[model samples]
Target: MKTKICGLKSLREIEIVNKYTPDYVGFVFAGEKRKIDEEVAQTLRRELSRDIKAVGVFVNEPLERIAKMCEKNIIQLVQLHGDEDRDYINALQSEVEAPIIKVIRVQSVNQIKEALTLPCDYFLYDTYSQHSYGGEGKRFDEMILTEVYKEDLSQVREGLQKPYFIAGGLTAQSISLLDNRLKPFGVDVSSGVEISGQKDEEKVREFLLAASKVS
Candidate 1:
């Protein structure tokens, strides 16, 4: 599975993940525990290798700010994880050069059905309930994902389909199912690797290694 390390903060952590060579390195542009400021993001952008994509995570940020951050940070990918609608997303896509990944909170079958209608470069399936929108670090009912989770690769490649990144509460225990059989475009992880609000290198390494073992 292509891996994306989100909630990234320190240069040391980003450098550690480089050995694993994760496909995407994300910076939290909003929310608590956000390690860096706009200036930090700009600096980190230069340090990131061309091969490794950079993503900016925003939670219902103003369009002007989002546009500015994307430019200032030089991030090429945008992951929106809030109540942003199609118009907001479309506006960003039109303004920014980066591709947009819309996060869909999976709570029930109906939510899944509605997710397919969103216009985005990628679809992120995350845990959601009455309380939050995304990044809660708790899992939703995986059984609800059974149909699409088990669907064949060919079926997943058909129309209205976009790349998939399974997010929320996925750790070593849940990484195995993301093998080729599952055919997820990538995996998105955050709190699963934390010890106490900081990125633990050992946990990060193990998570990557375990996920890499899947056939």
Candidate 2:
């Protein structure tokens, strides 16, 4: 599986991912403690090479602002982790040059099926949180994902699997544990790869180190 490290705050963190060369790097654009200002996010995104995809994670953000920021930062992907409608997602795609990633709050297979209709370049299966949307550090039942894999996984693999980035409570051990059964397109880490709720460079390096072996 590929790897993506989220909630990046500094150029140092970005450089870590760039040196390791994870498929994608994510930045949060909403919430109080979690949200990153547009100026800093844009500056940091500028430093990323074009080959490495830069993602902006948004939760209930206005479409107009999202389009503007993505354009300003030259971000390649937008990861939506809120209660956004299909039309809104489609409209956003029409307005921006970059692609979209519609995050599904997977409580059941039916929720996974709902993602099939969304207009997105990628799909991220993250832990559903009542409080936080994307980087809550909580994991959903892997068995739920396993069951989905057993059924229409081939379809997912054939279509969107290449760019699919898995999120929610993933660590080195978890990546190693999951490598055998579910070889995903990519893996995304936020809080699980951190120390004391802040981004840990060693944890990030070690997680990517483990992912390189599995992916």
* TM-scores for every predicted model: 0.87, 0.88
Off by over 4 Å in 1: 148-160, 177-181
- Model 1, range 1-215, lDDT digits (tens) per residue? 68888887877777767766788988888766764677888777777777888898888988887788777756878989888887888888787877888888887765666666666788887888566565578766666666555654453344135677888888877777543444567888888888787777888888888778864
Candidate 2, residues 88-193: lDDT per residue as tens digits? Answer: 8878878887878878877887677557567678778888877666647777877776666666554454433535667888887777777366657788998866
Give Cα-based local distance difference scores for all models.
0.76, 0.76
Misplaced by over 4 Å in model 2 are 153-162
For each of the candidates, give the backbone clash count. 0, 1
What's the lDDT for candidate 2?
A: 0.76
Q: Which has the greatest TM-score?
A: 2
Q: Enumerate residue pairs that collide in model 2.
A: 1-215
Scored by Cα lDDT, where does model 1 land? 0.76
Question: What CA root-mean-square deviation does each model show from the true structure?
Answer: 2.9, 2.6
